[model samples]
Target: MQAIVVIILILALLLVIFTLQNAMDITINVFFWEIKDAPLVIVLLTCLLLGYLIASFYFFPKLWKLKREYKQMIKFNSELKELHELNHKNDRKPVDDNSDPEGIELDDDDNDGSTFFKD
Candidate 1:
């Protein structure tokens, strides 16, 4: 896993370097816009900004709701685990080794007190 991540990081760095070496001009018909002397980094940054803007306008509210619900579910599950532990602790009872049949033994100080059933 670590090797794969390092390889991916190296590849991404090489891509960034390659892109940064090529500065280009672009034109947009939607806004009748023309950009001059724009580096690839700048173009990428603009695209990222526009993408975020579109997402915020059309998709962000629903994504935010889902994130909030995920957090709530995690909290509920943690609380449930605590509650289950507490219930299990309260449900345990003391036992006596003398109640066992042959071929079985129990330590006096053992608090678990689990009974072994014989067939």
Candidate 2:
């Protein structure tokens, strides 16, 4: 996998160098002013860097906020679990059918199996 990645990176770099060598002529436009004779790779890399900078500036804060919210949610869930355990610690009796000989109530509505309002 590492070798494949290295080969791909080398090919990409060679492609960029070949493209740059082929296009020696480049123009730079900055706020209505045109500058000439700039190297193609320099301009291309500069544009790439500028794009990355702009995107990072716009997106990094949101990424950090998401990370913070995720951490807070994890902490809140852990605290909720701890509170539940603490609250239920006093009553630790086994209530399963296999454990209890005397069966517990299965229904809460007087076991009539019919609604009071029905005919």
Candidate 3:
């Protein structure tokens, strides 16, 4: 934040110097409309602001979608973390070594290729 403040201060100083140095009046020709006696800094800064506003409007939808996707990823990450902790907790339980508690029968190689766990 301090670096940002410093950069802004430097930019402001540069702008002030530029504006003072280029204080001469100039004319702007835009298509058929001719603007007379306009300051160079005012014209340049106005164009810069208009460009910024235009670009922001053009990319607003894409920016909103990216923000939404980022939120979904955060939610998914939290849910995955909870599932991982639950699995880790289940891993520390005692084992029977005969039949698994999840209904997975061991040594039952019937070769039928059918799952016993039904929905």
Candidate 4:
């Protein structure tokens, strides 16, 4: 923050020096209007401000559209994540220990055509 303040102060000093050096009076002639004895710095600053405003106006709509699209994508992603979690939860089944009626343990790895039950 201090560095930014220093840089801003330096720029302000430079602007002051530039304004003092360019404080000459000049006449401006527009299409149907004529202005006399205008400071060169004020004219330049006004033109700069006007150009900035025009550029901002031209790009604001696109910026707003991108912001809205970004918000919609975030909402869609959250909804998809919620749906995937719900499906994952529904896919899992709880194991029941008392499912066997004969009280026998079943061996699932009996591959050699052995007995289907384990003692």
What are the clashing pairs of model 4? none
Residues 1-119 of candidate 1: C-alpha lDDT, one tens digit per residue? 99999999999998788676766655444466665555666777778899999978888789889999999999999999999999999798776666767647656654666545522
Structural similarity to truth (TM-score) of each candidate: 0.38, 0.64, 0.62, 0.72
* Alpha carbon deviation, residue 81, candidate 3 (Å): 2.2
List the pairs of residues colliding in candidate 1.
Answer: none
Between candidates 1 and 4, which one is better according to lDDT?
Answer: 4
Tens-digit lDDT track for model 2 on 29-84? 89989989987877877788999999999999999999999999999999999999
Note the residue pairs that clash in candidate 3. Answer: none
How well is each residue in 24-111 modelled by candidate 4, as lDDT tens digits? 9999999999999999999999999999999999999999999999999999999999999998997988877767767577656767
> Candidate 2, which ten residues in sequence have the lowest lDDT sum?
99-108
**Any runs in candidate 1 off by more than 4 Å, and if so which?**
1-48, 93-119
**Highest-lDDT candidate:** 4
lDDT value for model 2: 0.84
What is the lDDT ranking, best to worst?
Answer: 4, 3, 2, 1
| Weakest 10 consecutive residues of candidate 4 by summed lDDT | 110-119
The alpha-carbon lDDT assigned to residue 87 of candidate 2 equals: 92
